[model samples]
Target: MGYNFSRFTRGIAPGSRIFAADGEPLSNDMLRAAVPSIFATEAHESRSARFAPVPTVTVLDGLRAEGFEPFSAVQARTRAEGFEPFSAVQARTRVEGKAEFTKHMVRLRHRSLTNTTGDSFEIVLVNANDGTSAYQMIPGFFRFVCENGLMTGETFSEVKVRHSGNAIGEVIEGAYRVLEDAPLVAEQVASWKAITLQDGERLALAESAHILRFPKADQDGEAPAPVQPEALLRPRRSADRATDLWTAFNVVQENTLKGGLTGRVRNAEGRLQRRTTREVAGIDQNRSLNRALWLLTQRMAELKSA
Candidate 1:
């Protein structure tokens, strides 16, 4: 139940930082400091001439024009090796230069859908000027209770725009496409909230999520998972203690990604050592795991109804 909120606030990648708006639209200055990649004017130099550079800022401006206000932003850190480690200033310069071209994600809320109660849908934008990623938009849910941003299942279509011609126009269209699907996502959440899980079902859900976070080598493998499956069902806050499918999904998702549970693991010396799970800090891994968990819960709901 004791969750480390700081770890969640820290950016998804190493050396990265996250900036969230405090009841106001995030300023360009703040975003530039936290996610310089968002403002990159050109692609990485390694990119070939055929690789057209679609600056993320251009798409972001286009989204803003469509009334989508960015609330949070984060960028992955890319380090250049073989730098002069002795000079701290040079190392800092190398990191800053690479940061401008790395991958970044921004969470935006439509002005029309902004509210102060319950969960609301968000447009999650991911892109990179370095050709590591295309301009992708996914539907996200912002839970007010825990301030968690959850990526929806594959039921909500993801929009991707290549860096070629009219990329900005495509991205803006994609944002609206996600916006149009918000009602369906809301209906899904409502259904989840209405469906309550029995104790066994909750445990089953936890077990499945555990396997996802810590897969076994084989049935005969001696090494056990660092944490028990049941542990993930423990809610960080009292409000999330319900047995409803939505609550169960959020609890498991948070526990799996923001791992801090203690358990025992066999070390290289063949002795049991106390170990704690680390958070899923990679941008792509976070998105994939979140989507997988959502799909798992959706399947469970279908089975329960059948």
Candidate 2:
């Protein structure tokens, strides 16, 4: 759960990890080897490409040439009977290791000054391949103290590249955008930091976020009992104890997405039952949460502006 966040919080230098101390790319053979679906020889009968299918290797090679190196990789496993052989995998490589993953999501940060204090702008890239998802890059932030990975719900900052002949080119172009948006991103962060929430507003945000992330809880005319709103306010890490809007937002974000925060509700029998929420693991949940958080952040920003 803390795998991605811990690494990012440590601020692992891209140059340090991407290359050996002697200055060469670290062994990405391990990363490359994990994603055989992209290199599989057998054709996927269901997915016919308009152009020749671009090998994942080709995309990685192109990114590498541009100074990015692969650090982490993940692939979706297919359980359906016919789609057994077809799977989509995504590897995250970074420009000098500025991005860190929180449960497979990377926060791309941009800073204008070498010694600037306070928060910077960030984008979150969830390099995913469910065999259907376009390569998605969304704006996000990484909090140094709390080690939270936040997907800023700024729609204009989002970039997507379809799995086509131009996929690699599109991806490279998007990467450049990350570097270019430092000022705008940093400004947004400043706005979020300036906005502090009262306890009522914080809890209301949590309740709304609960429904937003877990709409299934409200299905079938029998809504799942709500989790204690305060539970969402509990910090996953000690560093996150601040009372500002950013900290308040992360409390909800982490609880909703990382799971294991306990909550209870009435069962069909009208008996109380407790369940520990799990991190959002499914690709669909991931996407939904990404969008939801982005929207929530925007709302907070607006509220602050108001």
Best by TM-score: 1
lDDT of each candidate versus the true structure: 0.75, 0.52
Model 2, 1-306: lDDT tens digits are 111221221122122111122212334464434434433322234446553333455555665576554433334333333322221221222122112211133333332321245343444444433234456666555444443345555555667776566776787688667656656766766666678888788878887887776667657886763576678778877767767776677677777766667778887788988876655544445556755765786787687677
Model 1 per-residue lDDT tens digits across residues 201-246: 9999999999887776224745677788988898889998888998
Q: How far is candidate 1 from the true structure (C-alpha RMSD, Å)?
A: 4.9
TM-score of every candidate relative to the true structure: 0.87, 0.71
Clash list (residue pairs), candidate 1: 12-281
**Cα lDDT of model 2 overall?**
0.52
Candidate 1 residue runs with Cα over 4 Å from true position:
1-15, 80-97, 216-223, 268-271
